[model samples]
Target: MQYWRKPLDADKIQVPHGEIHIVRDRCKGCGFCVEYCPRDVLELSKQFNIKGYHPPEAVLPEACVHCQLCEMLCPEFAIFVTLREEVETIES
Candidate 1:
């Protein structure tokens, strides 16, 4: 999705990034998060958890936008997203 013109504050604006966390044993393999993620950040893992269910894995951890959709949609409350802190370094 490219724009013909970029926003004036584009350089100043910071896009929120997110880090995804999954509770493997708590996941029931419903795949709600994988199916509904807007960024396609999650995928069903081939390995089974303690409960014999394939939990979701963060296949594209960098793509998350901190929307929290995965956390809200998970039936078992197994997934959550946290805002990733950006450390800017000052160049001498």
Candidate 2:
């Protein structure tokens, strides 16, 4: 299961960036997302959600490769990642 795949044309990708959304109420505090994150982007937050469970926090948003490993591993389907717009540099 490859989440992030680099294109053959390296120049197409400008910079790595993405956003993670965690549905707090749906989280069971299983720590799956935090543990499976390849980049250690997520952490179990100190704050508890409505269900009285700790949800995942994007501690390292910039480090996230948007792999979606967290989403796949989460049994509760509490988290997902969305890729940010690429800031492509026009080659002069």
Candidate 3:
């Protein structure tokens, strides 16, 4: 997205990141999570799960913004997202 002017605190503000977890066997090949993701983060996997259903995989894991939309939309409760923690290292 382009803007004429950037936000004054843009540099100071941090965008929340997320990690997506998918329970392959629990998925019913429903594309609800993939279809409803606002960031287009997930996609239907070509590989089939234990139940003979193509589960969702994170195609763009880094793009997740911790919105939890995929978790909410999933009918089978197969997917969920956790906030990615940022760790800083210090050198003595």
Q: What is the lDDT, from 0 to 100, of the residue 57 in candidate 2?
A: 91
lDDT tens digits, residues 28-89, model 3? 99899888998898999899999999999999987788899989888898899899895222
> Which sequence of candidate numbers ranks them by TM-score, best first?
3, 1, 2
**TM-score of model number 1:** 0.82
TM-score of each: 0.82, 0.75, 0.83
Full-model lDDT for every candidate: 0.85, 0.79, 0.84
Over 26-65, each residue of candidate 1 has an lDDT whose tens digit, in order, gives: 9999999999999898999999999899999999887788
Ranking the candidates on lDDT from highest down gives 1, 3, 2
Which candidate gets the maximum TM-score versus the true structure?
A: 3
Alpha carbon lDDT at 89, candidate 1: 22
Q: For every candidate structure, what is the RMSD over all alpha carbons to the true structure, in angstroms? A: 4.2, 5.7, 5.0
Poorest stretch of ten by lDDT in candidate 2: 83-92
